[model samples]
Target: MVNIQKLRFFDCNCSVGRVAYPHLSDIPDVEGLLKEMGRAGIEEAMVYHTVARYGHPPAGNALLTEAIKNNPRLHPVWVLLPHHTGEMPHPGRLLPEMEKHHVGAARLYPGANYHNFSLSEWCSGELLGALEEAHIPLIVDMDTVSWEDVYKILDNHKQLPVITATCTYRNNRYIYPLLEKYDNLFVELSRFMGAGTIEDMVERFGSHHLLFGTNMPQYTGTAAVSLLTYSAIDRTAKQAIAGENLGNLLKEAWK
Candidate 1:
């Protein structure tokens, strides 16, 4: 059996608040989430509000920011919208909120939540420009984002770091090329349960290009943890994928 008693993991993608679907099991709130993290051995995470993805960004972001206050282990990821409506904050006023909430990252979920805007340059160019300037990490899930749009965004904003989430083995056809083209791109590795593919990815791209994440509550963190724990990669590579890469990326955002 594989053991990871000493591994320190930092989960790069996670969410709180209730999802719109009632058929799914309930996800934990702040207190409960901490308990789940403790059990899973995930030392820290970059968490977004579940409502932020599907509902009002400010409301959910406020709730999440306040909930994790003074708790360094739970980092907040604010959801950003085009601000075409008066509901969300514009890029002009993001820095203060980020400072207040200690947020170093943001995400876009237009399609996931039924929002009717594009992440195209003409739509959110200013917001993307500001985030790129600040060096904040932007996470987009494969379920909601199109790779064609991702390519356009990456092509325009070469310096912005983007972390693609919830990818599976089938995504490699385009994903590998994106990785090669963009040094600033990082992949979240929990949903991509490709067995030995972890070793293959580490060999093709350095271990620093991947970050540990679990779609926790939706899936068991243990399953993903076990995969990494048993991989043929060396301890140094495993540790980097587990947490070090994420830690370094977070530091860069604040820098």
Candidate 2:
């Protein structure tokens, strides 16, 4: 049995993309992040790129890859801008990079980067098919895009495990329906704290569909950790959300 309280945490949502705001720019450095994670009982994390403006997606990806390369406690999630250049990057090349870099997943920010929603023809079946073949889960920012559009995107790729980032109280209405409709839809609990959001999601989707996430830098890691550590869910359920779910998903993919 998994020990919920003692479980390691894997933050599925994080971005070092681009510092668009001064507050974001002043966030803790990697060492500080590790200290915070240790304080919050997080044993490991899967982080993505945030420097969107400097080199677009690839720059952020490179930065994160370098930062986490030596940190066994951290894992890299590669960022891809399918809508950039008005054409998807060659999957053959991109997938190999992810594999070479030991990236565990692929992150997309249609709303954050102003890309066409995943439902767009540009983000075609071929692109998704490649991701599936490569066994990488797709992480998206649901808060930025419309739920209807996200749903349509999921409809086209039902077999893909789609994780969402930056979820908040406002998106619960959309979240509930999507969780109910698609077994592959999973949400990272980051911005959706206090507000009874975790309780509500637990009550509906149970712990299986939820994964622990600290928006980190954007939202205080302490607050996000508190939400899960203080939740009403049982220890087993908490364990699943905090780390087991993500671990299980990754193991399945790697196998």
Candidate 3:
């Protein structure tokens, strides 16, 4: 049996504040979020504000920055949009803001139901290029973007580290090919609950690209942590998926 405590999980997909559509378990404040993390033995988390997704990115980003200012364990993730619409600052201004606020990652909501923007090169090439050049990890949810768009983004920006968050077992076929092709691609473990799926992926592609995430407080951290606890992979690989891989990605962004 694996020792869960030794893994030191660092969640990569989390949010703070009341979402526009919130589950009963959603955590709306920093204190509650910290408490929940403590209960799950999660040492750190990269989080974005609900407002950043449901409201305005700048306001939500600012709110998240302030909320996590005193807490080193909670790193802020800023929601980004294509700058052409002027909904967000251009990449030049945005990148500096990220550095100033110590934001660790950037997220995109390009679905027709949400941000209503295209991820095509013609729309977001400048911002994508800047993120690629800076080595900042770009996170997108499979629900928020189509597999075709995901492929296009990965194909266009080979060096950009792109993490697909909230992935499910249904995504295996799509995710597998991407993993096989893109070394910079990563998968966040939240809703990725397929029996023996973790073991299978590790066996096939290795554990370096599998990241620990809870999707909290929309879901529980226990499920994701349990996946690692019972996984057949060796200790070192478990440790990497639990936290080391995410730490290394953030370190690269800071560099």
Q: Estimate each model's TM-score.
A: 0.93, 0.86, 0.96
TM-score, prediction 2: 0.86
* Per-residue lDDT of 108 in model 3: 91
lDDT of 2 at 158: 81
Candidate 1 lDDT over 156-249, as tens digits, reads: 8988888888988778777789988988888888778776778888899889888899877566677778778888999999999999988887
What's model 3's overall lDDT?
Answer: 0.88
Which candidate leads the pack in TM-score? 3
Candidate 1 error regions (>4 Å): 1-5, 22-24
Scanning candidate 3 in windows of ten residues, the lowest lDDT window is 1-10
Alpha-carbon RMSD of each model: 2.0, 3.4, 1.7
The digit string of per-residue lDDT tens for model 3 on 1-255 reads 884346888899998989767667657998888888877878899999988888888889889988888898999899998888787889999899889888889999988887888899998899899999888999998878888888998999998999999888788989999989989899998888888888899999999999999988777677788788788889899999999999999889956
Overall lDDT per candidate, in order of appearance: 0.82, 0.72, 0.88
- Regions more than 4 Å wrong, model 2: 1-5, 52-55, 83-88, 112-119
213, model 2: CA deviation in Å? Answer: 0.5
